[model samples]
Target chain A: MISKKKVIAVGAIALAAVLTVSGCTSRTDSSSGGSTAAAGAGDAKITVAFVPKLQGIPYFEAMNAGGKKAAEELGITWLYQGPTTADAAAQADIVRSYIQQNVSALIVAPNDPDSMAPLLKEAADKGIKVLTADTDAPDSVREVFVNQASVEGIGEALTDQLMTAMGGKGKYAIVSCGETAANLNAWIAVQKAYTASKYPDATLVNVVYAGEDQAAATSMATDLMNANPDLTGLVGECTSSAPGVAQAVKDAGKTGTVFTDGLGTPQSMAPYLKDGSSSASILWDVQNLGYLAAWAGDQLATGKTLAATNDVNADLKGIAYDSSSKVLLLGDPLVITKDNVDTFSY
Target chain B: MTLDERTKPAPQSGRPAGSSTATAKRILPLPVTGQEFVLIGVLIVLWILLGIFTPAFLTPNSIQPLLVSVAPIALIGVGMTFIIITAGIDVSVGGAIMLCAVIVAKTMVSVDIPLIGAVALAIVVGLVLGVVNGVLIAYGRVAAIIITFGTANIFQFLALRVFGSSTVNGIPSTLEVFGRGEAGRTLGVPNSFAIMIVIAAVAWWYLRHASGGRHLFAIGGNANAARLVGIKVQPRLLVAYALTGALVGLGACFILASGTATLDQSVGSGKELQVIAAVVIGGTSILGGRGSVIGTVLGAILVQTVTSGVTQLGWPSQLANLFVGIFIIIAVGTDLLRERARRKA
Candidate 1:
């Protein structure tokens, strides 16, 4: 008979082995090597990794859902993986992990556009079709970018909303999540330039940061509203800032007078929309972005060059790409207002 | 040494009571008390240096950020110091913060729970997570580090599932007041600073004078000895972790209330390292039995000042991290060397 200690040791070793094997298999299934191709000539099995800035965000979740839908329709394997946190290094690690898995393509929304360039270049060197969506790394080695909407268009739209809310003339403020964020800065710059050219009556009083934190956004919004009582409109450049600004307005009892708008989930902005504390909000179909990203990866894996007006025949219609730049624009932004808020679904 | 004999003192009362009392004071010299004085001196010197280097560092606008940034960390560090003093570590405090913040935000938004009620619920969640850590460490005799590390991942995963990577906004008015409201300025000083000062004072008083505090040190110094003396080691250890958890929960209230309830997976990521570094640098022995709340606060300020100063200088933000890593190494290295020297002497 075996000693009790010896028997326990053996059992522990066996359990460890089982756990190790299960973990390895699950990891493999979630990543590349899981994709299988159809028999059709152009139906090459491609594994595309759709990496968002972070996981668990509604925006990115929607984008992933859309990507999954497109992937299913196009018969491509979609690897939806990202760091739980919005750290560039974490994102880079995920990219490197996917590359090691020998993924066919990578669609990334970089947390830091410039910082991720080197890693994207490395992926490109390995023959992976690298693309960016929602956010772009212009200097990166990615072949294409599936921009949701033009930065200029977003800026112009925001400025237009601000001007309209302010009744064409008042000192307004902007609450940005990060000063260094390329997209937010781009929007701010465009809005500034547009204000200079188009809406000269509107003056931007200040642009403060909440450091991409929800509480900080709320506090900063409160500070901004309190500091600029004459401020007719507040535009939040980050998703966290919208509800924060609305809450501030509601608390201050200036809801009808001081209108707010920004990029955020309808679920988050629902109360504000209902109460007329906020005018409108804009965001892209994130799930569709993820879906398209996977579809685009499969197309590239099959060696199909993305052409202008190619109509890749996916659930999302009006798909177009610029071959020279290898950039894909994922249609237009969906604006949700009180009138059509019910129609908009995540 | 026999316990009966160790408890008995030699009956050599030749000297006068006043002289003997003075001699007794001189011999022991309050090791921990002297250490705090040195820490304060160092902090003052650093503050002066910062003021000289960056004129704006002393101003309200520049200093407010530092205070706000350090408040959450300092709040968590207070409980952490107590836990560490008991020879236990809570790597899951960051997770506790996240968990608490998520629960509070969800309760506030989804259930429309009042701010205080939501906050209470968040604290309860924190207590539960902490209790799990305590049970694993105290009852199961599992390594505190290992237990907390596992719990950290579990809490993070749970937070992700609950919040779904989205920030929760529309915090109620009362919470916003707690997070950002300034108590009326007294002599041009912000109320937040006063609050921090008061907390530091209370923590210092408790750690220095309380009997429970003395027991914590005794248990940390030697758990076997503590148990032999019937000191209830396990329960104290459990309470330490539970207190840390509650403090982390309280810290989360301030952190979440000060910001929107957006669950950034990265919100408290890698913060455990920083908190540990601050505790160690504050002259708290990682091996336990000795620490000062005052030292931890100063250490927190030093770390935040360095971070904010580096950012203000417009250096690559990574440089701040590099500096912090180096500071931890040097501080801990000096502490170890000094400790070794003391033992040798």
Candidate 2:
């Protein structure tokens, strides 16, 4: 048995030694781990982190690849972290951790904008730059939003493709991913408005929510076709649902008669396009959108204020910045048909 | 706790001392219990109604996919039935499925192995995970739910670490034989569903005729009494969980085949609840002692039917949960009433 006083003294000495060693290591780590460069006035590598709603999907994975290329070109470190599932609370937790790490800048495509606003505010208050990409948060929540295209642009493009397939007038329904997803809701609202104004003969009959499950979305699409005999078109509001709806249309053996299009990846929509189950899909240059987002994050990190006519990147020419809404436009949506779908792969 | 101190009522009058099968004298007209009969009747009614309302509901294109989706859940429910019968639960199987799926998926992507080898690899991995859970719970003397909940997070971390990226893409057509396409079916029946039926039938047999199976019910009914009679309680408990893990591995293969070429990390999210729901809705008691794998298979079919029926009817898909909740209440509520009546008798 050991004496209690001697044990206490020895334990105290060991604790002191451990603490001194840890304290010295932490000091050196902080000094050398880019904080000094981040704090310096010039010639420092900006570390910008991008958080997606969820990782492992083709879309976000493509975005990360593009962001990595941009980071390499711009001489910055691009850290990617996100939840495995699309849970708003998980996204908020990741954002909070990033805030604690005190990165130079953060580019987030938030799962829930309202819930993430406070965390974004904290990151901003800590002098770390904040920006939104692919999907915008509220105007006040981000420094600048790098939007692929305006909601109206995408909505009109999709509706136009559907109308053309329907011979300019027909009954159609919208199959959306989530009922309350901010980006999906915004695009749906614009698509409905566009259909009402542009094509009076084409009617938007119903809007179904599938909650991002492929099977659920496919079933909903088939049910829509079954319930509405005269239905001639479908607009998939998200990437995953687009292929699902197309598969449903093919399963129902209404390939040529019923046309489908939406915001989708080239790979998912390729077979459908080739088989004439879907006429076309509307999307922007995802690679460019990611590149522009990383460039913006780097710009904000390096203490440069974004204003109109800033000429952010040499490669992406003629890009305009909106000061009031803090949105950077990435230009018009491109249409991928059977002839051109082969060229694009996410 | 003593026999009287257990939370739930002990073995009722209708049940034999060490058996749940209706071999003892009973006043009820049929040997089969009310829950199983009620489930069959409800399922028949639901199917008839769905067919009448939606002409497309009875088609092979729709029914085949529905059955394909039902296969994995029911297969796992067989083992879950065994676990729930012994008054233990394994919530970590979902995470276990994830780890198995990514491992199998990555292996298939990297190396061209035979189908049997792929399946064996998945099952072995699952067995190891299940044995870990069994040893911790049975030997450590911890509560099954609490220990499983902790293991669930740990297993998820392992799966995520294996899934360094977001999704595994460009997977080959090696798993197409078990997929929903033309190759996955034989004689107009999905191979996965057929395999599930075969496994469930074997489980139903073993539970009815095997002494090891009867021992599980004995342990569930009264562990102290069973121990006094010289039954090894701890090893039996371990077998139940290890069996569940093995089934989860096979079921993960079914899931891998069910989807497209891309396998995502959300492969097994919330599956543990699905399996539990199937087991309980099949009239299996969560507290312990009473259940059947046959009822569990039927319960899985019933749950899938509701989901497919709701979608085919053009009704709100979310309304299926409301119907499932009602079914759970009715199934378990009547079982509770029956248990109380038997105790009073």
Candidate 3:
């Protein structure tokens, strides 16, 4: 017969071993199932993942927080995850991983339009609703792009701003982040055409790339300032470039002479706007962009077909879908100057 | 020590002590050979070929930018060589670079610290991080690879927490100039390249002639034997890691100085792999005990050439990475073959 003490010892050892293995397995299982259950709840629950070109940017993080607010209000599950870096391969891996987890819908701001096509196509094939927001993968099979503004609208606005700032006749320059960035390039092309047609007297002097890096943007801005001392106005096409350009102008003490404006956050551009270093900055409500993305995701996930006249019920009422382009355009962008700077939060 | 006596052939008569010493020193004057020589030669040939094919390849304007672009990466590769030589690795270098850069940028921008103070603080952060890794490996008795892999995530999280999601700009112009400004021209040559040459030469001198350097090799060759010889293995290992960390910290500052440190989650992502590839291709044995700093410099140049060349050729950027992957495999394969031959001989 086994002694009672030996039997108790064996029992304790067996219990510890089982608990240890179970603890490991359960940790993995619970983490995996947590999001799944969150996605599966009631009719109120809509799962939407905002896949930015990459993760961990203030702009994207702000947008994700905005999206989260909408999710909380609508009782939806919002998953915000993307590649840590802005590389096509990493983005592709994220797409595959999210698909395996079977997210109800996906909204991506693609890094490379063509490189991400196959993966986006795979998501489409899986009956998962995919939308492109912020940046488009035009060649990809993604449906219903949520545009902050029309490409032509952004182009026309940027050109008009430059023309007015330059008094409709002066040599000016543009600082862009990348040549291949579809949205920025589109705006540049439109501005170029506009400069030729509308303001023939206003010459387009030079265009430089800063690679979406702020330091590079600052350097390029400084270079432009040094290269064209008589340049009247500057347009920065990326968020990071805009603030850097504004700061460079301010530091160079050419604020009044060289009018500056572009896409920038209020927090970054506020000082420049107030100090008259920058004339204006154009931006949309990043938070509202997130809200609309979730609403669109819900519409597609619920078998509701998108139409031009269809009003998708959103936290902010009346989100219209343009069936012609399968695109949902957000409200107009605000041109934040000293007058209106206080009105916007982000 | 007389040159004439040193040059004289050992007499057919049995040689005395002086001749025997000379023979021993001459036997392996160059410790590296075979695959290492071939790898360096190949890289040199490619540089010449690219210069011929690309019109702007040899121009100061084109090449200066390439050198600037490769500087930060080359610095990291230098540190990685030491880690790899010790029969261990640290994949956390990229994250460590990011963390150090963020710390420096934050200190400069928010704390309003002077440039010197910020740089010193960044180096200290890197050194502390290296100590953490060393302690975990030496005392905790964990695998260096596993410890570093985990530490990468920790460093990334720390960076994000401190810097937030916005790119830090408006770095002091003085710092920027150091990274971007052309060093003083000597005979019309760029000063940055000259600085790199100096760094390479010093590293070579230390690795070749220093007693501490020999101890590093001995420990790498066999830890047990090194301990038996009372070499104080753990402290040396710690020092090697700390040195690498300090170098990486300097590299990060250069990168930030090159451009504004964007709160990019991917700031140093995938860079550790490239550094590892460079060290491996430099004829460094992955399992430890042997590496040359000059070979590492060549490796960095080769990697940089491929990246710039492919882009200039208008090929897809993906092809650049693919070529690196291929080169790494071929490099390691050749090293293995050479080792096999040496053992047989």
TM-score for each predicted model, relative to the true structure: 0.70, 0.82, 0.67
What is the C-alpha DockQ of each candidate? 0.14, 0.23, 0.11
The regions of model 2 sitting more than 4 angstroms off are A1-45, A55-58, A100-102, A139-141, A161-175, A193-207, A215-236, A246-262, A266-281, A301-311, A334-345, B1-31
Question: How many clashing residue pairs, candidate 2?
Answer: 2
lDDT of 2 by residue, B1-345 (tens): 121223223334433443555565422212344567767888899888887888677778777777888899999999999988887778888889889999998899899988999899989998989999999988997667767776887787788778775556555667666666677899989998999999988888777767788888877777778889999999998998998889899998988877545566667877888888888899888767888887898899999898777766667667888888888887777667766765876
Error of 1 at A28 (Å): 5.8
- Per-residue lDDT tens digits for candidate 1, residues B51-134, read 776545566645654566577777678888988888778888877787787777767767767766866886788788888898
Which candidate number would show the highest lDDT if scored against the true structure? 2
Evaluating just chain A, the predictions reach TM-scores of 0.85, 0.85, 0.84
Instruction: Give the Cα lDDT of each candidate.
Output: 0.70, 0.78, 0.70
Write the residue-wise lDDT of candidate 3 on A99-182 in tens digits: 776778888888887887888888889888998898877777888888888777787777787677778888878888766777
Sort all candidates by lDDT, best to worst. 2, 3, 1
